[model samples]
Target: MEASEIFENEDFLWRLVRHLPENSDRNRFSLVCQRFRRALLPFRTKFLFNCERYETGDKVIYLQFDPEKPEVEVTPIEWTGLLPMLQACAQTFPTIVSLSIMGLWSGSSSLPTNGLSSVLLHPRFAHLSSLKISFFKAGVDDNFVRLISTACCNLTYLNLRHCCPRLSDQALHSLAGGCTRLQFLKLRGHDRGPNTISDFGIERLLSSCTRLTDLRLCVGFNQVTGWGVRAGHALTCVVMENLNHLESNALSQGLQGKRLKRLSLHGAARLGEIERLVVERCAAEVVEELNLSGRMELKDGGLERIARECRRLRVLELRGVHGVTEEGWKALARHAEALEDLDVRDCYFFREDCLRALRENCQNLRHLLISSYFFLQQRSLETFCNARPSVTVKVYHREKDYVVDERVGLSGRPLGSRLGRRPTLYKDPVRCYKVRRFGYPWFEFLPFELVSLGIV
Candidate 1:
């Protein structure tokens, strides 16, 4: 075959694309949620060959030219410096769908709303749907609020979690007036803040943005009492964190009889209330995802009840709730035919055997996140993955620096085995955060193993 013909092959083109350099932008994953990853698509083309990179500076000393004791104050990076560099991306990728601007230093008050404000104001981003600006320091004042109101009208998903103290109830009101089509909204504010959002903001928002399906609001600071929890009909997914006593009841009353598909009582302590009010009220078959992360009060029967009711659950996140053992597993095994993603990261009581049902029944089971306390053996891993080849295991080992054994996985299966039962492809260990680096086990007979495995 000719060299041109070889290069022009579709497989060869994909091979070329796979080897390209990865993008250094850390905030990319913040926008893409697990809902997007539910398809289990390979992310090979999201890298950048042209995005600008940043570096730290080096200095010898502060200028003590004329004094015995001299001091200098280092200032935070100005947004003006970073804005021009990002313009290329904005200009090139004009119709950017999702934009998330997060993280401003604690003491620094000069919030850089300019960069995002410029992007939102651009005419090219008319179709932008998702905008998340979280953890930024104060000064989400009227200017930024007005900018979002006028510019981002077509937005469906907006997350302003713990963003700024200056983001008052009025800002939420403005957002409601403008973004009339928002389906997913997260307006979680900090506890210690000058700006407080009462039932006024939420009531206005619910009244205006009538198309809300998913909502996550922190009722920790603002006490939204009587009129706040009245509007709840089309809400399919609800995640309320840091809720107090009275607010929880109000939430229950509002959410009664709603056919919710996903419910997360995050940081909410009342397990009985959750089971009685939320679980009992919602349409059981429709509840696909349940996240009771950090709720220690969950009894085995509560989870069992969840299993019995929401049998079609696809995603289960029991991060710190440790009250289920065999009942939960058995329920998942029998009914969760659509189970795909499972996260039991901090559940110390759960073992590797807890996933036996999910392994057996759920044919499309792809991602499993478990604690290192769960004893996962080589044969067990091999047997599980051997049954279903598309499985990926992520073990959160508590050790600071963990290195796996070279021959820990089941590599050399028999030649006459199933076609899909190939070698175990281990995903990189996630540490600190989502800094994913590939894990390569050291093989003694590397070439021989490759040859035996028919890769060479």
Candidate 2:
């Protein structure tokens, strides 16, 4: 049956919406649904009502969306049957775990906060495992934070990105004290002026709430040095930036001997901070995925250490670290036995030999991103690709710097001349040669040949 025919059933529709990704534009989906049903879905799981500036690529995306008149107006008088719907949902689905509401903008005017706040702060949402609120620029301060913490005792994931107003150390302390089960806490994209988040706040939050496995703080720190804070032993993923030597060392010391799976310090450019040293110390054996994309100070020795220590690494990103030579690149055969995804895009010292070795040893390696050094010749590219039937390799091109369309390598050889026709390296034929002859992006260019002939 056709997809359009299958979606006619309401059962399928509700199931689809429930499984639809959280980041999907529900507002747009609701507008489309207006054609099918006169009103929105009223799913009770997710509802978005806002009048912010909307953009889809180069054009505005909302049909009945006027900047002055957003469709769903949330006022005390004009509840638009929403309050009744919520009451119905609460009666039906006793323990709905996820809820989110994005409120007013800086310039855009708002509705009555009391009604929405009352519904959100109710006992119905006490068992909520996840709560994500953003852009509530009205007045979601200490009281709101305090209320959420007190009510949602078992909340594992709480993300208040870009929604802090009058949120102070008091609110953070209250949250840490109250919600002991919070595992994923992200409080980034906050307003800089009113928000007072420093080492003290972070330390207070982490020390008390010891169950966190994924913690991300994109705010600036003050007062307390790095050693003062203690991220719990259960933490598996951490994305930290601009951490000094002391803080990095302290964090490493705390997380030592733990089963840390993902460690991302992609933006730290400090050479003298001993941050690389911290990496060497912390993720010795257990870490499965690591991202040190732009740390140029990491030398061949450090790369060797990672290869030696992290034997079970599944994913490794060394995008801009150019210090590693063929020795370090080839050393992956000895260690990193289970390496599946390897990104060495801007590592200028990378060669084709590394690919040959990785193919022979690491049979499970599925994804690879190599530098431009190997893209000079089609034979070289094909040789590496042909060896690994299960791998997807994409050669990096400087999209901005290099003017020519990077369909094919700029070898300057005439497209016809190589296969014997004419002597001209112009646009159409060269691009065809690139897309067909030399595989671009997906090395297996055509599907028929890709499977039947085994990854051509």
Candidate 3:
């Protein structure tokens, strides 16, 4: 066969595009020719529409893989032009499974009275399985959510952020009644909203979405006491952050007996009895990742209980927790054999004994993050480094506002080795380097980026 004939074969091109790993590579491949672009259309599943208002006009830059051409367009349109843009996208990508729309609100200008109804009520988006809407200054309310539930009945994942305070339990009820296939849901309300979604709404949604496995309620939802989460029998991961009215008993009741694999309770200040209840009931053996950061009531007793019960725990974050002492470290070192990543930054009580315990017992540990407040002697840090040459040790010096890697000495070489010369110091005292571990300095707890990347 001729070379052109082989290249023009649609079946071969489709097979080739399927093997491309990254979206960038596939996009570049599609740009090769119109035939390649046509072959790539069926595989295009994700679309991102980001609208930004400039002094010139309102610019809409959307990532759409049009079979006619692979080039993206930057069009200037009015605020009302959003509906037309979405309509064009739906017609172009009929097989789209995931969609993201950001920056919908155009400054102080009010949205149309119908809200997103004109954009989301289209029949072409019936196949969409995942939807994300964020950064709306206004207009998104219970009516908008109800439209989503009605339009996207097959949606398995939904994320809503910074919506209006008027979005009450009625929206959740609508979602429960319409989208029963939901498996992942994230709701982050505006910072200055009345408590719109209380335990009642949460219970209704959990009971209706029987397949839900991951749920995150962040920043708002102050009225939620976490008691309604018990209805989700299939839940494997739960993140509840900044919920001020979260009661210990309700949270404990919700968590008990569920086979959770990951749990994060950030800013839950009143975890008095819930600490023991969590370790004993929910996280005994199945939980692998746990973040209890900023829990002032968590003491050595809670730590010891965690070490004893959660034997399979791999990632543990205890940042800003000061109540733990040397005794807690000893218990963790003795039992947490599967521990690989540990963050204890800002723990003023962390000392030399704690370092010794970790260095001697945590054989599987690969990443250790700590704050410089405890100020362990340089000799002790060097000893720990020499003992665990494979481990990545990061110390955040709050005073200098820099990070130092204990694994590398001042000479930028492995700590145990000397290059036969005095170490040279740089002119700048502040040195910063990115930690490559899964969950590290950038994210004090679980890395939410994994969710966006579809890895978790």
Candidate topping TM-score? 3
Local distance difference test values of all predictions, in order: 0.56, 0.55, 0.67
The candidate 1 region of ten consecutive residues with least summed lDDT is 60-69
Model 2 root-mean-square deviation: 9.9
**What are the RMSD figures for all models against the true structure?**
14.0, 9.9, 9.7
State the local distance difference test value for candidate 1. 0.56
Cα TM-score of candidate 2: 0.65
My TM-score estimates for the predictions, one after another, are 0.64, 0.65, 0.73
Model 1 earns a TM-score of 0.64
Q: Worst ten-residue run, lDDT, model 3?
A: 447-456
Per-residue CA lDDT of model 2 for 1-456, tens digit only, reads: 333333344443343242444454756555434432322344222222211112111111122221121122121112344555444444444455776544435513232245555665666666777777655555466777787888788899888766654566887788888888989987654324355555567667888888888876544323224443455666787766434332555555555555678776665545443334435546666778888777767776777677677777899888887767778788765577888999887886776676667777887788877655533354555565556656766654542111122222223332213343221122343223222222332222321221111111
